[model samples]
Target: MNKSFPAIFALALFLSVLLFNYAAAQSTVQERIKQVENNLTENLQTNDAGPMNLQKRMEHYKVNGLSIAVIKDYKIDWVKAYGVADAASKIPVTDQTLFQAASISKSLNAVGVMKLFKSKHLDLFADINTYLSSWKFPYDSLSKGKKINTANLLSHTAGLSVHGFGGYEPGTPLPSVIQILNGTKPANSGAVRSVFEPGIRQQYSGGGTTITQLMVTDISKERYEKYMSDQVLKPMGMLNSTFAQSPAGLKRGLLATGYDVGGKEVKGKYHIYPEQAPAGLWTNPADLARYIIETQLAYEGRSAKVLDQETTKLRLTPYMNAEAALGVFIEDYNGLKYFGHGGANEGFRSGYYGSLAGGNGLVIMVNSDNGEIIQELINSIATVYDFKGLNKTEKIKLANVSEKDLDSYLGDYQLTPKLVLTITREGKQVYAQATGQSRIEAFAETSSKFFFKVIHANMEFVKDDQGKVTKMIFNQGGRIEAKKL
Candidate 1:
């Protein structure tokens, strides 16, 4: 009886051991499945795209291709490219394929100036007049005594009239740097003009940066492109990058053809820009990422390789009550703050935003007039990383108002004496149009504050003594004022 009982106990214990092993294996398999699901989910569906299939999602958004570089853990974790480099070329965009960076060139240009600044060759607050020789600003009575400094120019507070330099068509006669600055023939305007006194308001002026190029040229005694190359690009090892204004852009076959909004390829000959400091840079995303990485390192008080710690910190901080610091815009979205720049020229629009903390950076560039598509996707990427609120939301006035109340507010609100915004109603929606401009859809925040999402700005309506809305204010591009027109 004792021997039989012992055998039964051993058999029962063996069966119990097998059941425990089986349960443990099942648990491990379940964990593996969960990890896989998480990875898949992270790759799919952003806030704007909703839950459609990936292929359909890409096509619907008109994104021919996209390249994303993730900068985290103090280094680039990964970089990926999707879609064709040229839709008709049947050539896929690889990690090495180049994309025209457009206005993002300004950020790189800023780095160049800061390099000089770090060496004590350039002063931020010194009068720009000391650096000029060939061409000069018209300098109306308003700006005669006011000194335009390098810091003011870097911050876009130079009070220049032209917001940006116009790129010439490929076949058109290229303007010299002096010609472009003078706004002469073969150029868009005769000369750069001053709309307001320097340092009075924060207005974006790419022409102002041209003055920086001129200053660099005078100080370095080299062509603008040569100076940038020797001081900035070469030191950074930006092998493929070039100042688009350089003759080398033509020889190296580095220039990308500008496109129209409808995807029609432009046939004009390549036009040269003398004003290389504003939007003349031509480089790829990979090289640009290197620039961004250095900035991040500089912020951490680590070795930046180029700019010193003091100058880099000054460039990152807000200058003159503007959202932009130095060449990039300083903004806080969700809980994370970042520094980067956005560029738009001809058919291209690109933006690169990176977090100051250890999250990845996002760079988006498209050769189409579809700024909306890029902006929306950029916002989506931010949201995916849980960046819920950005400076992107439009502010419109009106609170708890019904559809019936929207009619009274459907009139024009003047932004400035020169700029008038007309508000018209189409069904339940309201559209605002500036004089001599196409009407754009305006999103509302409350009842009094409305903002344009197509660009950066907001509109607020002020009421009169009788509770009647008397005036409305539209704020955009660093210019703010009321319009009673």
Candidate 2:
């Protein structure tokens, strides 16, 4: 044979070996995925809340209705609904019961935008200003020439403020979409202005997604909700989901009433998010699971209908310096990497998380303001699956302390620039209330640590340089420091 022919043959042989190794690795992963599915099926059937009384705890924590969906091996193997959808009607919450998915809608909107990316009509990192028609972002002197892209908006790195949209409650005149963007009346939930230069640090801004929605309307010349229905919801078969922004839809009676920590159902107030892309869509756990499965398929290169493999990778990749990726928070929990988003609306809370490595994932939603309870419950269940990177360890262990000492701990503490904690004593017992929240009972877990029986969090008093108790840092959903004010 010629010398060139011999070299080509050697190169082909090396390529064969590499392909063989890759195939073997993929086979091993599939086998592990099957095993995880088996374990989840068994555990869910026999799930009696062993290490912690999860089901009972949900009820005690005033969770009116809850649902869970698990995706394993590219299939939605489990979907379970718990408790009553309507407490008064005694209607059981079934898989079909439509719930306000809240901010979970943002993830779906992000997917819709990615579809535009596949058409080569949208650039994720392009200047958002290029798509604007009605008005441009009022960039400050520092950020006048800076650009905000789809990637920045998705990952919350657009340097915008006002973590998210606050839905319209009853008796409030609904703000127009422009009014919301302008921080006008009825849309005061988030600041209507940018905080820092575009592509700076991570700051949760549903306003960014609102801008995304505006851009979609401007480019497609169609309503945001209609575009989403045609492009994302219909393809995904989310039949029960709706983009309706009226209380009449809610009053039609399939919707679960939002509840507070005390189990008081909230009515006359529903979210009319001008930030439609961020918090507008309402869906069920089943539909949300399907959306998540699509993400998994995209990652594996098995599907490219909505987004190309390269664009999908770019969206999932972190944009800001934070762990939050485009439209979802990405973190290494336990030892496996997970990608999902958490949502909280008026009286409802939901979280969707799954391993990026294709092991398993979970979706949990509760019809209560106390979504932290669901977070704790899911984190506990994840631990059973031996998820390696979960940093959630905050728990409630109540202790009976002398009533007199309660007075000493009673004081106002500041958790953040926005969060304030007020401690009040009644006899030997101490009750705590955060700003804008009703008073709650704080049971002593230890002499130093106390737990909020309603929400899944604990407060521990910290001493200052004088050792006279200057601060009380609360550890619950995450670390939050509260200095005595």
Candidate 3:
């Protein structure tokens, strides 16, 4: 009985240690989640607005639903969903709820195209017309006789027209790819023609991605969605994702209803994207996190489930010194390198970012047109996780200005040939709207200077010697002087 007593004591000690470690790990996860949910920020600053909660931010932004997935150590650390998927039905969003991936679809399309390149089924440098069978690109002198290649198309250096598409509402007549490319009747956008010489610069073109969609169908003799699912998504374990133009079967109920910035539900819930390669993906963040992890692992030469290390490197490499690498954009935050893409459909906005070296990243999807909340949530997660080179916030304070002074700054300013900033006054508030963008309220930092609460942008009203407003210097990404017109 003495020998048995020792064994029993050891078993009890082992169980105690296991339970203690488990409880500690659970507590750590809860703390991380709590920090992320409460620390939302735009510029990581403390102002009158103060620290924001995720639910409050969602309400403030008029976002109806949101899904997020966080990646740590090359795996999905956690995924969370918030708000109602359908306000009318009060259907709550869940981890499985699907949102339009929008332009993130291009990232996966690039992977599938690279798979073909790896199999020797296609060549990256070959003229795109070589693989295209159903239709041919109408090359004009704008192309400078430079034939569009797979690399150009993937990297957005093909000089193609139609930056994006406004998808058809449910039950609306959808245009065929050929019709869309030709800019014919019933097509919502212009032709996908060469706007400049290929390989000169990077211009985002979802139309170019659509051409690849057709190419995949033409060359593989399979539907674009099927090809992508079988070749890239399934192998990477993104089982919940699909490029189907319309949600069907079990996906119907899982789809989140789209909402406008005003919190109004879009008619028919959401638009149908026939251009599957650019804006047609219906997926959740957990599935996208899988793709990010696979990309990280493959780049590290640890996995070749879909793309091998050499091919993944080629896909991530920028073409012609452009900021874009294949379908993803390469950006440096502080000093950390990241490759990711942002997507915006008519009523859906989504974005994802993954580290170039580490397996750390995040994916955010919202069912509202307003994208202001996406970055704020990312900032919160970065802060809580102590991610390198992210969540750098600055303190800012608002200044008091007279209503009469605000009225004087109201006018139209031309920043460029195509860009204009229109400042309007409503009662005591001032709002600024750029051409082709929604109106955003501007709060005064000084009588002549104003800043936006939702975005990292500022405006300074410049006056002439006579104290008359002449021009305004717009500062957001950079400074640009716009003459008051």
lDDT per residue for candidate 1 within 88-203, as digits (tens), equals 65556566655557678788888888887887788888887766776565666878578888888888888886787657765567777777778778788546667788887799
Question: What are the models' TM-scores?
Answer: 0.71, 0.76, 0.89
lDDT of each residue in 427-466, candidate 2, tens digit only:
7567888899788877676777887645668889876676
Where does candidate 3 clash, by residue pair? 44-393
Most TM-score-accurate candidate: 3
Per-model lDDT:
0.67, 0.73, 0.89
lDDT of 3 by residue, 262-345 (tens): 999999889998889988998999999999999999998999999999999899888877468998988886667788999998
What lDDT, from 0 to 1, does candidate 1 have? 0.67
- By summed lDDT, which 10 consecutive residues of candidate 3 come out lowest? 42-51
Best by lDDT: 3
**Number of clashes in every candidate structure?**
23, 9, 1
Rank order (by TM-score, best first): 3, 2, 1
Off by over 4 Å in 1: 1-65, 246-255, 269-272, 333-335, 387-485
> Higher-lDDT candidate among 2 and 3?
3
What is the RMSD, in Å, between candidate 3 and the native fold over all Cα? 3.5
The alpha-carbon lDDT assigned to residue 473 of candidate 3 equals 97
